[model samples]
Target: MFKILFQLLAISAAFVLTAPVNNSTTGISKLNSQQYNVVPFGHVDLDDYLSNSTTFANHTYLSAPGSQNGLERRGSVHACQGSFTKKLCITGSNAANLVGALCHSISVALEIQSGNHNCADTGVHSVSDQTQGTVYYKYKTTGKGCTTTAEPGTIEGALHKFIKEKNQDKICDFVCIRLTHGGNWSGYVGLGTSQDAVKYSRCDHEIGSWSACVNGDKGDR
Candidate 1:
C-alpha cells in the first residue's frame, strides 16, 4: 500500500499530456483561504470503516481521445473490501495498521471527520489504466460552510495553492498528498512545505473547465 502511494505521488516525466490552458471560469467560489481545523486522526475500526459503501461520485471524466497523460477513467469501482483484502493479504494487527493508513489518506483528502464513512467508504475504488500505470482515485469533500476557513491542511486549501502556482490539476493525483503517517494525532492545518510537492502530483480534469474541488462550493457533477 505504501509503495503504491509513493509511485502515484512521484512526478513522472514519461506521461505527457497536451494540457491546453483551461482558464475558463465557472460558478466556483472565490480564493479567499484561511486555516481550517480538520478532524483529528484517531483509532479507527478497520472492519467497521471498510463496511460503509464508498461513493464513486468523484473523478471528472474528460474526452482527450489522443491525449496520453490525461486519459479519463472508465467504469466504476470494480471491487472493494474483498479485493482490498486479497490485494494486500494481511490480517490481525498488521491489517489494522494498514487499514488505518488507508483511512487516514482518504480522510485527509476529503477532510472527513473520522466516523463519516468507513473502509469500504474510503478504500481505493480503482487502479490506474492497465497500460498507462496511472492510478485514479474518486473522492467527495465539501466546502459548504467554508467562508474563509477550511479543514486543516485542506486539500481544498491545497487546491487554492495549486491554482495560484499555475498547477495543472495534478495535486489531486498524488496519493502521498492525500496520505500521511497514521497515529500522529496532530491537528496540523497545512502540508507544511510538502504542499509544494503536491504540485508534482497529478489531477486529470478537463483542460478548459474549472470545477470546484469541493462538492458544495463548485464541484459540478
Candidate 2:
C-alpha cells in the first residue's frame, strides 16, 4: 500500500510540473505585446511635405485700444503667399517637430486601442471637438526637448479614458498638432488631409484603425 501511494504522488507531481503555463491572468501576450517603431523625421522638403493647401485670407482690421489712447486704430495685415498653406509656411522649423509629434500621437493612439496603457507622456497633448469629430494634440515639454524618448508602455491614462467615453465612430477626422518653442509660443502644422499623414509615415496598415477612429467610417454597414 505504501509503495502504491508513493507512486501515485510522484505521478501527480509530474503532471503539475508538465502542465502548460497560463499567461491569461498575467496579461502578457503577443496581441498586446507588439512594439511600435518610432523614427525621427529627417531633412524633408517643405515643398513636398503638404498636399492640398489654402491661402490665408488677407484682411485689414482695427487694432484693439492700447494704453496710448482709448480709440481703436486701423491696421493692415498681409497674408502669406505660395502653394503651401499659410499655417505651414509660418511654422518654420516647428514643422519638422510637428511631424515627429504626430507620429508619436499615432503610436500612442494605437497602443491605447490595443488595450495597452495610454502613452500620454509621449509629449502629445490632445483636445477633442465631438461636434465636428476633430481632435488636436499639442506637443510640449521642459528639460527634455521634442526628441525625448517615450515610455515603453502607455502613460497617458487620462487621454485613453476620455477616448473610451466617446463613441468610436465619432472620432475626429483630423488629429492636428501644435508645436511649441521656448516653452510658451507655438505654431500649427496643418497637413491637407489625414491621408497626408498616412503618406508621410508610410504606416497605413498600422494606423488603419486609428484613421477610422479619427475619421468616421462611411462604408455601408
Candidate 2 yields a Cα-based lDDT of 0.24
Output the lDDT of residue 162, model 2: 18
> Candidate 2's error at 14, in angstroms?
38
What's the TM-score of every candidate structure?
0.20, 0.19
What stretches of model 1 exceed 4 Å from their correct place? 1-109, 116-121, 125-135, 138-153, 163-175, 178-183, 186-221
| Count of clashes in candidate 1 | 12
lDDT tens digits, residue span 58-110, model 1: 33322221222332122111111000001211221323222223333433544
Candidate 1, residue 20: the lDDT equals 21
> How large is the C-alpha RMSD of every model relative to the true structure?
19.2, 21.2
Q: Model 2 — which ten-residue stretch has the worst lDDT?
A: 212-221
For model 2, name the residue pairs that clash: 118-155, 118-156, 120-156, 125-137, 133-172, 172-214
